[model samples]
Target chain A: MRSGSPVYRRGAALALLVVVLIALPSVVPAFFINFVMTQTLMLGLAAATIVFLAKYGGMVSLAQFLLFGVAGFMYGNAALEAGSRGLNLGWHPWAAVAFALAVTTAAAFLLGALASRTTGLYYLMLTLVYAVIGYFVFAQITEISGPSGITSIKRPELLAAPVSLYYTALGLSVLAYLGFRALGRTAFGLALQGMRDDPVRMASLGFNVPLHRTLAFTLGGFVAGLGGLVNVWWNGQIDPASIGIGPTLILLIIAVIGGVSYFEGAWLGAFVYVAMSTYLRDLPLIDRIGITEARFNTVIGAIVLLIMVLSPQGLAGIADRLRRRPTRPRRPAAGSADETEAAIRRAQLIDE
Target chain B: MTATRRRLPVLAAAAVAAAAAVWVLFLATDTPAGTVLDEPGAFVVTALDAVTFAGLLFVAASGFTLIFGLMRTVNMAHGSLFLLAAYVAVGVQQAMVGKTRNIDASEVGIADWLVPMLAGATAAAVVGTVIQQVFLQWNEGQELRQALITLAITVVLADQMLREFGGLAQRMVWPGAVTHFITIFGQRYATTRLFMLGVAVVIGVLLWLWLNRTRLGMVVRAGVDDRQMVRGLGINIRLVFAVVFFAGAFLAGVGGVLGASFAGAAPGTDGAWLLNSLVVVIIGGLGSIKGAAAGSLLYGTVVAFSPAYLPSQYSFYAIILTFGLLALVLAVRPYGLYGRPA
Candidate 1:
């Protein structure tokens, strides 16, 4: 969150967190990290994409999973059909990525074009209805189901190795996060901020507001779709369950828990969620914690409710507050409040 | 303007005829004309059954419409509330006659369906009030969060229900023996269906009367239009909302009992009915008393007859049809059939 501080200026706690993550492979048991890392990465990307919709385009679509589904299917079918047809187009990793992004963005464009016509809750309902429609179609379609969802969708050749695949996903996520940060400060991003602030003023300025709105959706679609693709590859197959309305809601929970304003919040949320699931699944102490594995959802739901009530600004805000808190000084007996005061002054001056 | 208005019925009649012709063509091609299709009474029987189911659907959906329309909130756990009530009613009957399943209908000996109905309604009201107070009241204006939180609750509840109730369809043993089958123009049908239909009619009419003719109804109507203003006037908005939720849930419970009586209660009914109500309320008009009625009848008729007339494999086709209808209605009247345009 305070990436600008560098190692020396970085909060000692964050440094410790980084160290823990780096050494987690050795410290934690193998299976937990494997499961946690995988799930966190998948959901993080999905929820991170949701941040773009909420912060930039001012959309809250419950049916955003439709876009995610489109991405997964595109990759799966491309891989299956191309591999069978002996075409490198499907087998090639980049090619599959391109297809996924393209299809997702295109569908985003179509949906955005329709959705952009309305505002507020109407847009949400339309998006939700469309997503449900898409989910039903995919579930019912003989082509997709085929007894089991995209069966034999073997791990691809390039990112076949789990550890290697993990790194690649992690890398992509970092890149996507950076992309979001950069775009949030750009002119196009500024225009989007304008739409969120006052669409009437933006539209009256002849800014093709609807087109920009559509592009925002397309952007959301691209990120979510990419997440879907990675998840499919990670799981070695895509099941109908992979892209249900329920999972989409879970992604929303992640976004809500992690603070939707900062892009990194998505990663943090995903990480927490996956860890929770893993802990619930494997740990016996979860029962002692008053939640059985069977009752894990209750725990997760409670946590989400608490987060929304307590710190709706999410993990990102917490990160900001921690970063702003004064660091340990060389001089003994210097209180942390002094640093916080200094930081507050700096923020005030910056605002001025 | 007067002449054009007067001719509206003529235009409507012509359109209805055209639509009927199309429906006939679709059914004729889709359904097989065998023993099941024979007996002219079969047509009458099916229509009556459809109407009965439609009435029940209307009762359930009106609750859905009222909540969503007024609050702009989607109660994803609404179906669970419905199913829980049915389960409550079942628990009552099961106490009378041991075992919740596969009992002879004649063996059920209890006085007046009213007692069980009251129990179902009361249970539903308490449960609904609790949910509203606990989860919904805090998240009043937070639409997506409310939907999702309730969804999580629904999932947890559904799993827990399945575990407790055992994944079997349990019958709500009706009071008194359904000793005789009622024949409507020589079409034999269950007495329960007729009774359920009567229940639906009474519920619908009573609700309509309550909403329109009562002071509380007037206040609720005013509150629906502008909640902030109502609160400003020192009205206990929260209490009114509790009442609305209770009434809505109680109605859903009524539908659940009636539905369970005929269709049998099983797992997954919550989701099915929830989705169906979404289509119903959205199509008719969210929050409009009349809209829920119209939407339910329209939806129920299509759902009931579609199976008899169309391919059985496409039971889900009913869902798609509802979706299409929702879109069409929203297109024509973006606020739903009776919703006030923004």
Candidate 2:
């Protein structure tokens, strides 16, 4: 139990995290528990959707926020009572949630199909255009979503308490993290990784590369929709401004800051972003510099730029470097490559 | 055989499109009485508006496509450069005339306009060069990194500009020489718009000549096609990259000045113009000047004409039509009309 094996260490870390989270509401102030912790969990979940796509699928998407917004919008429109400025379908809240997730998944699948035709930077541009177009469409279609958006989305009685909501968000985040971790070990996930490494080779190996990409994108959308569902319930409303380019970019910034390549980095980045945005302006140094809340974007931008320029791999990479610093470098023995090649050839011959 | 076969559907689509256009422009009578189709004068005005706006979009997009072609960097800050130039031009114009707003248009001379334009272009060019050299140069071949850096620069620039210039929409006073209205086809058109069109044509011709006849332009074209190969040929590609970036930024600045005079420059125009450039380049084909021109004209036409011809109740759907054009063009030619795969 006290061994220094990596698996044990990982298990211990996770258990400690669970214990800390479970005990947090009791120890921390209500404001911290409700606002900061809960908000961080929700944003972390949202950023996780981006991390999953980027890390596993080798696709950096700007449309995840749009999908999140879609789910919220669909849910709001479906569940709003009559006389509201939405579709006012008056469906049960649970049913609305299911419908919203379904819609988001389908929309993501379609977007993935269209966008998978292009790769790399083009993929980014296409998704960006889609998001921008969605923004305009939502803004212009005032009949469906009023200029101000839908409001008065009531949460279920079970999650009415701030602590319960916080715990729910925490549980969802943990599940999502574990699910993504497990997915990465699955055959489909490995194939997706291989496709990311070299799509042409994967396709030549008889893999349906586009289908896998689309499926991965759809899964990301569903997860993002879950985040959206919780976000709407917490905020009790959804608006165009919430899903605009500003929020879109902030999500990407959060993912990059946390470590786009690591699943855990999503929440880590979210925690930093939420805390900074909330408290940065109150800092004595920031106040003395005359940088008000209005100028917060500048600070954030500078930080992102610094992070990108210094370490493209993000905070996770920095931590990884720090943790591995004590390990001694091993020098390869001369002629080992020849022996390995001969062994591989012998194994291949035996298989044949 | 495949080329001809592909061309057939495209030809058929164009014919159907042309027929639809004719029906909308001349044959449609169910539209409201005051719409463009009902009035020939309105039709001419809208058409000219489309062309002038297309010229402006082309000017802004040309530089973007060039940089994208050579560097494979989207330069998301291109719109920021444009907006910055506009604000600078407005500020300089106001300072020269010693008035913040409502300066006498008669007193503004060519120097007043020309000086501000030059100042704006110079400022934008300097900023653009600095961004490229400082942030993007070291990360060559890392397209995503370059894009993200530019996006950060855009956010910072936008915030700073908003702080400095405030939220008011500002327009540069046009030169007295081109402030009058010119009549064409018996429809009065703003002379400033015609002047803009003329400037666009001049710039287009100059760029075409440079690209076809100059040594540096040849290298740029070659770089666009195969950058690694061009670098392997012992050419100083970094120098070319800097020169192209400078020119591109300079063009954006010019566009800023022109756009300010055409329509007022405001806080959110950066995002709007950025979207416009993206759509234009995507429609035309990435990295192709001719494609930019074609895409701009088509996009401009859709934007200008969609609202004019749509029913009053459906006017809001004009935006949908614009994006619909994008979707259609993308479906037909994924690389765009004149674009080739990268």
Candidate 3:
């Protein structure tokens, strides 16, 4: 019944998905498990980053995928540079993540600052533009990155098993979510939310609105950077098709369907998306229905429309509301927590 | 009126776009490839290709800018809508000819007479309006919610399409006598392409007049600057939005139809076209027709010419160039090429 604080309930649900995901590689056949679990985790990371943008920053940047794409390329490039004898920059795969994260962070910092000035749909437009360019960069750059792609890409060292890679992705995603959670509670986080809902008032209060947004930009980048690395790691390669605008926007869809407002949204979106895409891939619905896979995008499109119409709050928001009513009377630690703890939790609710 | 007097920013944007175009041409000319870079004739051909590319891109982006600039709704479904319309238009072309759509530009001369190009565009508008009426009306000013809702719609539609249509890429074919190439500047090009370029320009001019000299355009501009204020002036904001949505969607459809005549509509066209439109609108200015035109041309030229000079392996160099340009423009001018300060 989720009979406790909404936080407890949410934690419980995420924990449940996590446990299921952890068990997947072993519990299910390796073939199906790897694809599903990896995709879910990657999207979960993407969606979590989006939550930071939506919940704290009041931004609707469509270009989260730009970070995702860049991060993937960074990973691929880092690997290639490390692996190539002529251009050796030897670092363990784990260490190479630093290179990728740094690039992603810098790009996010630069782009986010630009995007931070824009609100609502304008931000979305800028983000989309960034994504397109990122896609092109992914598709074109021969020496730097491109369509020919960075192949023969090996997985990171110290993560030997598919399960291990999945777990590292899972662990990092959790860490990122926690990082966002911690950040969302800081003086800066509060100031950013204040700006999100009311920038002029926050400015009147001398919060330096753009500064908080810039910090938020950095944080969002850091999280998305993690996603990019893991995404390439998951796919085991990089190419124009993988990194271009199409896949980038698709990642946005994954984040949105999962509910961009909270960390849970990412995992949820990943789950739904992976399940649906997997179903589409394995099933011969196109054959049975007499339509080609090229046209299968309608299924994704129609579902998105229905979700928009029927559940604007998304599955997570709806779950929270339901969790609030009828089942909240049973918490054991009611009123025992300090006021600051409650405030932090309340803020988490809004952001999440 | 006085903001219009502040013409420096607009001029600056023009300068930036011009500089980018020159940079691309310079690099393309310097490349070592024979067919790609050996001839002065090749650069001219490529530049023309860039112009056509920008023209088509402008058609895709104008409606997007209008919808976003005026109302702060980021319609993620916009791309899907364009893709859907293109798919529908291609279907129409195939039906009229009673054949599979090979969509070779070689076969397009007879198409003008068979189905007025306007029809496909009109169908897009109808679909756009219907989508707005049914899906978008209630979600008017809530950006994130709107984004999510539309995203859901996109996913569902994508799946439905895959189920209905096989994965094979389809094209809109032009039949018989119309399929011949029109040689311009001593290089062969599709006449349909020339027609498309003309159509895009004419439409741009007409749309400009509609917004500037016409009463409707004035209202739309006013609406963009301040929707609540426009309503106070006795305009039905809802109806205007519906119309804008229709026009925007219709343009996408027209682009889809003509686009099939060139690149062919495939499973992934929505994302590709959407990304290009986003770039055009962003570099230019959201919701500004002039901005979209400038941005489209900027992006179009990059698309046409980058492959000639950039290491073929690094072909997506244009994207980096775009981001670099966008970063520079946004850093210096946040409102895009022609967007007024908010």
Candidate 3 has a TM-score of 0.80
Worst 10 residues of 1 chain A by lDDT: A329-338
Quote fnat for model 3.
0.74
Give the per-residue lDDT digits (tens) of candidate 3, residues B1-342. Answer: 155544665677678767655655554444532243346666677778889888889888887887877776666666767667666666666666655644444444565324734566676678667767877788676555565566566566566665555567766665455455776656777666666787789879988888899887898899888888999988888888887888777778777776776687676777777777777777787778889989898778767766665555555454565566677667655667886644
**What lDDT does candidate 3 reach at residue B29?**
43
Candidate 3 TM-score on chain B: 0.84
Scored against the native two-chain complex, candidate 2 gets a DockQ of 0.30
Candidate 1 is graded, for docking, as incorrect
Q: How many residue pairs clash in all the candidates, one count each?
A: 0, 0, 69
lDDT of 3 at A139: 61
Q: Residue B102, candidate 2: how far off, in angstroms? A: 1.4
RMSD of each: 8.8, 6.2, 7.3
TM-score-best of 1 and 2: 2
Instruction: Please report the candidate that would top TM-score against the real structure.
Output: 2
> Cα miss at B149, model 2 (Å)?
1.2
Candidate 2 has a TM-score of: 0.90
TM-score of each: 0.80, 0.90, 0.80
lDDT, candidate 1, A77-97, per-residue tens: 766653321122345556776
Q: Can you tell me which runs of candidate 2 are displaced by over 4 Å?
A: A1-4, A325-352, B1-38, B182-188
Query: Which parts of model 3 are misplaced by more than 4 Å?
Result: A1-39, A80-91, A201-208, A275-301, A326-352, B1-29, B32-47, B69-72, B94-116, B161-166, B173-192, B212-218, B233-237, B304-316
Candidate 2 lDDT by residue in tens digits, A1-352 = 4456976888789889989999998888998888888888888898998888777777788899999899999989888877558898989888898999999999999888766645556667777777777787777777668568889988766788868889989999999998998999899999987766656566667888768988999999999988888889889998888887778888888888887877778889989998998888778887778788999999889988998888776787678768877886322111122222233234324323
